[model samples]
Target: MLGTLAAVPVGERPELLAEPVAKAVAGLPGILVAEIDPELADTAAFCEAYASPPEFSANCVVVSGKREGQVRFAACLVLATTRADVNGVVKRRLDVRKASFAPMDLAVELTGMEYGGITPLGLPADWPLLVAPEVAAAEAVVIGSGIRGSKLAVPGALLAGLPGAEVVENLAR
Candidate 1:
């Protein structure tokens, strides 16, 4: 006889993983993927649902801006307790005319990830990955799996392994 299975909400389904995120993490070693019980597809929700308080405190918020007629996006990982100094550091480093939080629709379209599920992994190879130096110091960090309800815990080193990640000290103030 087949046993009855409990139904799970879309935001809490364990198997609802994103393909791109899986592909990006395929060959990485020593990484653990966890499914969150609460919906963590957005920054605020993610911070609230994060189990490790410190991790939540140092969350990354992805932002997109325009410069020289080109669209640029960056993953600004900062303390959830703090805000990324976008205007002072990110804009200056990217040499952009304007820097602003990318709209949810554009962020999803450009990254090919669901809103609130966007992560640095699987991002376009050309897009810059700017990480706060302090976050890099952690042994492992939890990041979105390109879908809600799932997160990937990866070694700090793996983040730098991405094609164009640049380590930036004081990325946020």
Candidate 2:
């Protein structure tokens, strides 16, 4: 059941939030987009409110780094139970001097996704998407729908179908 919002027919929904995901799903073969109640944009708060142990929610983390003097960003999706090892794995993988969480404003501007709703679906093709294997193992996961007022339940495989998503083990700690 779709939750309350100005509902747009499946074909007419805005591309900003759900459309990219829809397109990604189309290529993946067989995944359905189930809608869920939107929560406050804060990951911690969302986990506390909906997650079983209040800490099992997986958040899409955006990290920024400079490689060869050119700035780049990578997104890592990890469970709230553990933090994305941005300073460890991400920095090493990107071969950068330093890596830090992108500021919310910058994240929003670059990704065209709200602070809390940044899914990898519509991210820039060149941006690397490192997904924790644990997350990919789950049947379905709840994630932001590119808007603050909605959420989406999508299969793990669908997530991997995004342009540059790579399933990595122990991406988080």
Q: By TM-score, how accurate is candidate 2?
A: 0.78
- Cα displacement (angstroms), candidate 1, residue 91, comes to 0.1
Q: What is the C-alpha RMSD of each candidate to the true structure, in Å?
A: 6.5, 4.1
**Candidate 1 structure quality by residue, lDDT tens digits, 1-173:** 00121222223433555766666766667666555653544555655545355443345566767776788778776655567878878887778877878887877877788776677777877778888776666676666667776665656777766778888877867
Worst lDDT run of 10 residues, candidate 1, spans 1-10
What value does the lDDT take at residue 15 in candidate 1?
57
Q: Whose lDDT is greatest here?
A: 2
Which digits, one per residue and each the tens of the lDDT, describe model 2 over residues 1-173? 12232333323344435445455444443333333345555666554544434233467988999987899899998866778889889998778999999999999888877777887767777889998877777675666667665555556776765678998876889
Pairs with backbone N, CA or C atoms under 3 Å apart (clashes), candidate 2:
none
